[model samples]
Target: MLEILTGAGLTTSAGLNAFIPMFALGLLDRFTNLVNLPEAWAWFSSDVSLWVVGVLLVLEVVADKIPGVDAMNDAVQTVVRPAAGGITFASGIGTETTTVRDPDALFAGGAWVPIAIGAAIALVVHLAKAGTRVGANTVTVGTAAPVLSTAEDVSAAALTLTALFLPVLVAVLVVAVVVGLWLLARRFRARRTRGRAAAAPGGSEWTA
Candidate 1:
């Protein structure tokens, strides 16, 4: 139960920022006693891996803050985020985190199941976020790009930490992410529809 929550939280955070969960998990597993990664996954906490993840995270952060570059970044992240989410989710489930007692029995039938489920979860959240971002960019003329990116970074970091140490709170954060993204997407869609309707001839929305 707690293992699933941790994985879900990590995967969800990956949807927002691909490297945060990885970086956090790696650091904790390497430096602290909070996370004991399985032998197969121990490489995540290596110094070299941390450096690579950090560099990618920096690049992702900078690119996602720009206007047009953000869109392009999202396009690229459409793939990277899902992959990262899968890895984080699987690692979260397989690792012995502070909250994850007896992580081995959490999931059966090999690692593919958790990986696939995590990928799907991340993909859905990513879609919602991407949709909301597009709408936000359109409505604000890209002025809100930096703000949105910063908010996502904060949320990702919070979720990663909570999922690792205080998994009981992960459900609340995941729900908030889902609801926030859904609301933003709907609001943007409504605004875009209104804009389209107003622009059509005779205020008609029948344009093909």
Candidate 2:
């Protein structure tokens, strides 16, 4: 149960930043005894894989800070992030270091539940993040994109770290972020409606 929560937490973090949680997991698996990734997932901790993902992570951070580019990046990540979430969740859940003969072996027994849950959680959060970015682009004219992107990166990192220990907190934070984005979307739509109404030919105020 706790393992499932922890994996879910990491999946939520992945929705915000696709590679960070995986990178973090890889780093942890390599340097510390805190985690033991399955043999299939051991590549995530390899030097080459780490270096490659690290470079991509750097690129992702940079690209996400740019306004127009960030939206495009979000569109690309709409697929990648959720997929990463599934992989991360599956790897995390399957890290028990058990044999195929073990009845409790999650990976060996083909546990799809965590993978599906993780992907679902990630997709929802990804939608929230992408929607919020689109809303910011619409309302702020790209001025807020860098700041928001930075905030998202920080949030993803924080959530990734927290998921290793306090997954329940990650769940709460994900919910809060989703709700916040939904509210922002509503506000953005309302403002756009008002603006359009005021611009219409008959929308102008009349004088006696």
Candidate 3:
């Protein structure tokens, strides 16, 4: 379903950066016909909300670019990212005004389902991101901060745009994220295995 895909994309984006999707949704909803937010969510697109979220996004971006600060930011976002994902997913899908011309036909229920699903999706993504970040920071001695943070920000932005314009294409971003996370996880596991082996009774191990 396009509606579900839209939710998936938005939530996935949130997992990477909490405010990017929210800010994009608000701007698009306010300026273009790409999104028609529900009446109850009108405040989300208001000038006040936009400014507030924009500021928060700026702070988040700056903080995420530093190695140690990034880990702390991730700890803080453990709650924010999921909450943002839930809101975006629920709003994007539950309303029949976005995703497809006949969204009403596909989305007949409330946002609770999408919210739960979005939160779960975001939590998994958040954990993967955090785990990989910790590993990368350890391996690169904090030198990977800006590069990885920028990559995540760019990915989030792209995912948000795709979710808004072509909901069906969201699957591509999902697959990419899955693959990236899988590779990172594999590398992390290999490193851990090597660490354990090297510590075990003089197992053959070399460090460069």
Candidate 4:
């Protein structure tokens, strides 16, 4: 189970790492009586519900592709994801119930571990992708870069759903997509930079 969680964390970080913590929190909420809201969210009602997980997974993918919309989504999700991850981790620590015997104690006991793990994974994923975006924007003034980012968003969503539904297949696919995207984005950036440099005045060493 630890191995599975670790692998899932890595794969999720590749795309929707920003939301992994939130998803984890949602999972936590299902196990313990930490948050009343998880109970309200039908999809997060049960840990074993494939349908709900699948829907959330799909949303993660869609959220990644909405052009400038992802920036807004990221801002909103930064807080939401960690909260969700905390909730999921808390839920995973115990069983669901209308009331928790000792909410503070239970949270302190075993809930923090998974929440920390999930949040760490999410932070790494967001940083990597955010770095990539910053590099891309520096090279290309935020033009069609959103298209590539959108692709990554979709990939993240697919990987999440696939990991839940078909772990083995998704693992292979995620690795392939990540490698492919990295190469493609690098090449695209290089070409754009070269083109920009060429269009400028003095060869590739101009000041402005």
Candidate 5:
């Protein structure tokens, strides 16, 4: 089920892809009845809109080009992504009703597990991207470069709302690209690091 949701076709679909994570988050929230504040902000913060989110996402793609900003962005995103995920999940859950059961009871009875799962997934994805950005910065600009990392900040806000109100397709596509980029960047960084190390002094002596 997870594989099917995150696959290329689903991820590429603008409406479904963007909202998948949110839907998952929502389902979890529904089962748990937990109120996550950060997620709330992602959805309600007027400062961070869909347009802003989209712009930030675009900026993140070239974050390595800036340096310090990239690292900062990673740090900020670390906290923001999971919260946003949780909020999206919770919000999504809040939208639906359990027809046969008392809504309050249902919320209290089985929401946390899904919410926790959503949060965990969001955290894992967030950390992976953070790690990737760090690597990209290290490779392209060394450790001291300063790049604006707030690129995704906007996207998070926008995506959160889109997941909440617009078609889920957009959310899924964005998430897919975000995940895909992270994977590609990691592989590229690994290859480059290996090539660089192999070319260094006494390089041949080190066995793989």
Candidate 6:
């Protein structure tokens, strides 16, 4: 139960920023005895993976702050984020069991369940993120995107780190963030529609 919650939290975090969970895991594994990777997953602890993920993390942060670039980046990550979520979920489960250590279990039947759940969660979050970002760009004219990106990065980092110790809280926070963003996006779209309607031919327009 705890493992599942932790995995879900990690998956949620990955959906927001795919590299954050991986980087957090790698950092914990390298600096402390907090996390132990399976034998097959030992590469996550290697300096090379650390450096690569770290660099990508930096790139993602910068890209997410730019208006047009962030949208393109999100589109490109449509495939990548789900995969990262699946991996993070699997790793979370793997941390709790010795089954992951067996090469044969990598492709075993039951292993796919968590992966699928993670992917689904990630896809949902990704879609929501894309919608919200598009709405934000339209409403704010890209002026607030950098601020939004910064908040998202901080949230991702907080969720990733919190998943290590307080997964239930992370889950609550993720739900809150997603729901709040969805509501705000919906409101923006509604306003946009009304504005367009008012500007249409034969529609009322105030001169004052």
State how far residue 110 of model 4 sits from its true place (Å).
2.7
Error of 4 at 139 (Å): 4.4
What RMSD, rounded to one decimal, does every model reach?
2.8, 4.3, 2.5, 8.4, 9.5, 4.0
The C-alpha stretches of model 6 lying farther than 4 A from their native spots are 96-109, 204-208
Model 1: per-residue Cα lDDT over 8-46, one tens digit each: 999999999999999988888899998998777798899
lDDT of 3 by residue, 1-208 (tens): 7777877899999999999999988888889787877665667799999999999999999999998999999999999999998888877674444456554434445547777888888888888888888887876777887888898899999998888778889999988987897797678667766876877886767721
lDDT of candidate 4 at residue 130, scale 0 to 100: 54
TM-score for each prediction?
A: 0.92, 0.85, 0.88, 0.53, 0.49, 0.88
Total backbone collisions, model 5: 43
The lDDT ranking, best first, is: 1, 3, 6, 2, 4, 5
Error of 5 at 15 (Å): 18
Q: Report the lDDT tens digits of candidate 5 across residue range 59-97.
A: 644553466765675576566555555544443444422
lDDT of each: 0.89, 0.78, 0.83, 0.51, 0.45, 0.79
Worst 10 residues of 5 by lDDT: 96-105
> Where's the lowest-lDDT run of ten residues in candidate 1?
199-208
Between the candidate structures 3 and 6, which one is better when assessed by TM-score? 3
Runs of candidate 3 exceeding 4 Å displacement: 95-99, 105-109, 192-208
Number of the top-ranking candidate, with lDDT as the measure: 1
For residues 44-122, write the lDDT of model 6, one tens digit per residue: 8799999999999999999999999999999998998999899888777566322222222343468788788898887
Native-to-model Cα distance after best TM-score fit, residue 88 in candidate 6, in Å:
0.2
Please give the distance, in angstroms, between residue 121's alpha carbon in candidate 4 and its true position after superposition.
Answer: 1.3
**Who wins the TM-score comparison?**
1
Ranking by TM-score: 1, 3, 6, 2, 4, 5
- Residue 169's lDDT in candidate 5: 49
